[model samples]
Target: MEGKKKIVIGLLGESGSGKDTVAEYLREKHGAKLMRFADPLKEILHIFFDKISREDQQWLALQLRERFGRDIFPKALKRRIENESGIIVVNGIRFWEDYDFIEGFDPGYVIYVTADQKVRWERSSKRGEKSDDGADFKRFQELEQSETEVHIPEIGEKAGFIIRNEKDLNFLLEETDRIMNEIANK
Candidate 1:
């Protein structure tokens, strides 16, 4: 596998924009291992609260960044993936520092998955995940103004590949496969 390039793909997008779907696609199709920067925070939160809600996760992440450093999650994720081979898909890249840290690994590709706000809201509502339990248009918009959500648009602008996921699952999978091929060939 000397000629096989090990790709580190950072997925960037708003909530319910299909980032997790794309990560799952990469895992199943390309045998890419899935990693999330919030994992460590989630683990720590689970210790304090039996059930860690999405809001708790976000609050903790912000607090950790403010108290510790902006690069805390990125540093932890880099350490976790340092020895991993083949394709690795990182699902929760929120800050510019996260992007830069992943790119430092070489052969890193950031793919930004996006969809219309209405469509994303619909998808989010239909998914019925605990994170979206009481989510509405106004709440979603409010979340977008948060410290973490504010950075995603800029990250999407700078992503190597941008995929608009407004259509069916097959369409998304096909687009993801095409992007994977393009990255693999690069």
Candidate 2:
């Protein structure tokens, strides 16, 4: 296990499926390093704008992918992780291309988190992310139809582990702990 990559967990989920919570749990409890496939895009966009919205990010991703290919962000993140070690949680694996690329890592795995739509909307409204504030349920539903979110369910089917995040934070942490144990013991 030492010779191989420690643990590379690709997380896929919709807007409020607790992917961030799971990633944070891994980092806090298991000493995992957290990553997101969109880090490069976020960094670039951040330089130009004080805060980037999800719609803006989706647009940027679409524009870049059209020019550099769909696998561009995943490839960039892979380079970032190349020399790092320890449990690395790559959040935001919404596309099959992201899953395919990350899972190629020697110790890669994916976990998909899901939650009730209404519950997700409620949580998302208050999460206070730059893009999600002022979002109504109607807007949340609309975002689901966007190209960036369309592949989440399909890509989630490919996850090595799938967990539901309901209304309880304790339940989420426990499930995350169990999943991490199972992954590490592999």
Candidate 3:
């Protein structure tokens, strides 16, 4: 609300829904700066494990919230956002706190990425960054129920822009371009 002029975008999506991919596309195509809530959590995960998993990430997040407070990440991210300008994309908007902080940006938009559960499961299987990436469908379903992921769909309902990522990369990028173009006209 001060002198800085920034277009903030909050990205909300379930695991494997292509949120990170879209953020990267924005970064490369729109010169958008990216900030993720899980960045700090993932940094901590990297310190302890050779291969980080979604389950562990959820566990760590809950632990931190219990030790500190629910606002820990949101507060830290708010500080980070204040320092950044231009097209800034805040990935992993899971909680109300995340959305509330992002709402302060004058030209902000929430982008929700959605895909069929099966398609997302398939995509998750191919991504080896998480140790449980290749987990079976049953396990994948359980992981989706974790606290960190449970609120995604509800929050996604609040998005002004929605992108379906079930198709090819080109289609996803095309949809992304469409949204960016729409935002530009705003």
Top lDDT hit: 3
User: Could you estimate the TM-score for every candidate?
Assistant: 0.93, 0.94, 0.94
Ranking, TM-score, top scorer first: 3, 2, 1
For residues 1-186, what per-residue lDDT tens digits would candidate 2 score against the true structure? 334456788999998889998888888887888989888779989999987888888888888888999898887887678878877889998677899987898878999999988888888888778665559999889988888889999888878999989859999998888887787688
Q: lDDT for every model? A: 0.84, 0.84, 0.88
For model 3, residues 20-44, the per-residue Cα lDDT tens digits are 9999999998888899988989999
Where is model 2 more than 4 Å wrong at Cα? 1-5
Q: After superposition, how far is residue 119 of candidate 1 from its true place, in Å?
A: 1.2
Q: How many residue pairs clash in each candidate?
A: 0, 0, 0
State, as a TM-score between 0 and 1, how close model 3 is to the true structure.
0.94
Look at candidate 2 and tell me the lDDT of residue 55: 83
Per-residue error (Å), model 3, residue 175? 1.0
